[model samples]
Target: YILRGWIEDRSADEARGLDRAGWATALTDPAVGTALEAVHDEPGRAWTVEELGARGGLSRSAFARRFTALVGMPPLTYLTWWRMTSAGRLLLSGDAPLSAVAQQVGYVSEFAFAKAFKREYGIAPGRYRRVENARAAS
Candidate 1:
C-alpha cells in the first residue's frame, strides 16, 4: 500500500506536469499506466512487450505504439533504462556485491551488467560506486 501510494503520488506529479501541455487527463489512461506500473513494480522481471501488453489488456502492437507515444520509448527500451537506473541507485547507495546488484536488476551475468551499466552511465558499475561513495563521504 505504501508503494502504491508512491506510485499514485508520482502519477499525480506527472499529471501536474502534463497540465501545462493540455494533457493532464491522460493520467486517467489505464493501459499505459498499468503497463508502467508493471514495469516499475518488478524491474527484476524479464519483461517483454507481449507480457506488458497483456497486463494492459492491449494487443502487442497497440501497446507498443501507445506506450512509445505516451512514455517516450518502446516498452522494452524503457525497461532497460529503468533497470539501469534502478541498478545505478543500488550501486550508489548500498554495499551489495556487483553480482548481487546485477541479479537484483535482472541481469544474470556480472559482465553483461557491467557492460550495460557502462553503456548507460558512461562508467563501469564498480567505478561508479566508488565515485559515489567518495562523494558521499566528502
Candidate 2:
C-alpha cells in the first residue's frame, strides 16, 4: 500500500513529494530492502545523482560512492534497469499498441521504445507481445 502510494505520487510528476516515500526512506541509512522499495515505487522516471544526493543529504560524489557500495550500481544504471523492467511488464500485460505502451513508459516514440525494449529483452516488442498473447491463450 505504501509502495503503491509512492508510485502513484511519483508518476504524477511530483518527484519531491516522492522523495519521502517508502522506497526513498532508507537511502542514506542504506537498508537494502528500502533501497529496492524506492526502485519499486518509481521504476520509469529518470533520477540524477545530484537529486538523489540531496535527498540523501550528502555531496554528489559521496552519494555516488556510497550508493555504489550499497546498491552495487550507479543511480542511472539502476534507473534504466528499473525503467526497462516496468516497460517489460506493461508490454506483457497491456493490449495497448506498442506506441501507447512506449508513451506510458516515458519514451517519446514507438521506434525508440521498441529499440530499448529489444535491447533489454533480446526480442522485438511485437514478437514478445505475440508470444505473451499465445501463452495466455493456453
Candidate 3:
C-alpha cells in the first residue's frame, strides 16, 4: 500500500515533467519497457547490449536503434549514466567505502570506477562525497 502510493506519486510527478531522470517516456513501448525495467531492477549487473536486446526480444542492431530513438541515448550509455547516478546517490547518502560503492554499481575495479565517475561527474567520487556532505551539513 505504501509502496503503491509512492509509485503512484512518482508516476504523477513524471507526468507533470517533474522527474529529471526522463525514464518514464521509454516505458510506453513494451519492448523498450522490458529492457528498461531490467536495467532499473539490476543496475549493478554487467549488461551487454546483445543481452538487453534479447530481453526485449529484439536483435542487437534493431534494439540499439529503437532504444536510442526512444531513450535519446544508446543502451550502454544509459547503463553507464545509471551506474554513475546510483554511485552519486550512494556517495551522498551513505558512509560506504569507495570500493564498496564501486562494486555495488558494477565496477569491479576501484580505480576504473573512480575514473569513470570522474569522467561522468567531472570530480572524483571521494571529493564529491565530501563536498556533498559538507553542503548538507551547512
lDDT for each candidate structure: 0.76, 0.65, 0.82
Maximum-lDDT candidate: 3
Question: Ten-residue segment with the worst summed lDDT in candidate 1?
Answer: 18-27
Selected candidate, larger lDDT, 2 vs 3: 3
| TM-scores, one per candidate | 0.80, 0.66, 0.83
After superposition, the stretches of candidate 1 with alpha carbons farther than 4 Å from their true spots are 1-28
Candidate with the greatest TM-score versus the true structure: 3
**TM accuracy, model 3:** 0.83
Q: Rank the candidates by lDDT, best first.
A: 3, 1, 2
lDDT per residue for candidate 3 within 1-138, as digits (tens), equals 323433644654455444334445667677788888788778889999999999889999999998887876889987897788778888988899999999999999999999999998889999999998999899
Candidate 1, 1-138: lDDT as tens digits: 324443544564465342222222223468877877777778899988998888879999998887777765677976887788788778877899999999998999999999999997789999999998898899
lDDT, candidate 2, at 55: 63
**Can you give the lDDT of residue 102 in candidate 2?**
80
The number of residue pairs in model 3 that clash at the backbone is 0
- Residue pairs clashing in model 3 are none
